[model samples]
Target: KNEGSYTIGKVELEIKLVNRGHVSGNVKGGNFFKASGFADMFGNASKDYQPQTLIETPILAENLKPGESRRFRVVFDYPPYFKGVTQFTRIFAH
Candidate 1:
């Protein structure tokens, strides 16, 4: 999200290493507007039923300026299901 008045461009995000689960694939991000609905970086509209606009990484949003925010979704894949103490993992983004 670009809260500043200047336009933000070439934005990149790096996820810190995880001790438990692992990142499944590249991060996905998109923008949602009431007029146009959810759309990916490529400007492809999401399905009406699904309404998911998250796309693979390498997203460039030079147009994101003040009051404009982008949404990102990350998925962590685990080895398998386990019936033991609940495990926790902390994710840090930069």
Candidate 2:
């Protein structure tokens, strides 16, 4: 059996808090794909990778600068059943 996985892309967002201490932004979404690779030379594939509903996360911009940029780490628990494949994750804005 050949098992392979990779990250195809990511959902990134940037919020610039103006000097007035206010910012605004939104999170984009994407569709989840099950099996994405060819199974064999006969052009066969699998679709066992079930799609899951995406969760909405809240954003809070606290103590951010107008020109300063920082990397926001997203902390969440993934179900044990989620293995490997191409997918896009969420990027937070502050």
Candidate 3:
């Protein structure tokens, strides 16, 4: 299981979305154990804030157990274009 899920910062923007993973359950379902995240655009936290994006990692595991955590690589379908320019150029890439 290499491909994981997405975890973004705190902000809200309307962008095209791609189906990532469905996270549900308290015990049996796999809640995100660990996940990498980013913002829709590149910019400083003061100028541009990160918003929560959906997870897009493919689940290779056949079954999810309780207390089990999954990893996901979250990405947005479209780039975060705010105002007039793209915001990612200034964001620190992980």
Candidate 4:
């Protein structure tokens, strides 16, 4: 929840994986959403201005007003059928 008096700045999504090829997912920011940009963990670290996200629809939200909260949904599939494969997943909102 946005507990401040002023609106929050832009929002970004980040997905990280330690050992894996690639994973796909979906994210939606309700109705009042605007996809400003998308980036992978590496792209974000390297400060690359490119859309390399795995989110199916990386719909970024508009101004997150004060004391207002928005809903988001994330759906992803498990790693392929394998054995002894570890996948470290992390999702962050910036």
Poorly placed runs, candidate 1 (over 4 Å): 20-62, 78-94
Relative to the unseen true structure, what is the C-alpha lDDT of residue 46 in candidate 4, on a scale of 0 to 100?
Answer: 68
Candidate 2 residue pairs in clash (backbone atoms < 3 Å): none
Model 2 lDDT tens row, 1-94:
0011432223344322111101122222333332233432223334554323234353433344444344556554544444432234444432
Model 4: per-residue Cα lDDT at residue 69 = 80
Residue 25 of model 2 has an lDDT of 28
Candidate 3's C-alpha runs over 4 A off are 1-62, 79-94
Q: Pick the candidate with the highest lDDT.
A: 4
TM-score for each model = 0.33, 0.29, 0.20, 0.40
Q: All models: lDDT?
A: 0.39, 0.34, 0.32, 0.44
- Report the poorest 10 consecutive residues by lDDT, candidate 3: 84-93
Among all windows of 10 consecutive residues in model 1, the one with the lowest summed lDDT is: 16-25
Write down the lDDT that model 3 would get: 0.32
**Residue 21 lDDT (model 3):** 32
Itemize residue pairs with steric clashes in candidate 1.
none
Task: Name the lDDT value of residue 23 in candidate 1.
Answer: 33
For candidate 1, lDDT tens digit of each residue in 1-94? Answer: 6767777654654333222211333333332122253343334453433222222243435467777887766653432321111233332222
For residue 90, what is the lDDT in candidate 2? 48
Model 4, position 27: C-alpha lDDT score:
29
Report clashes for each candidate as comma-separated counts: 0, 0, 14, 0
The C-alpha RMSD in Å for every predicted model, in order, reads 15.3, 20.0, 18.4, 13.6
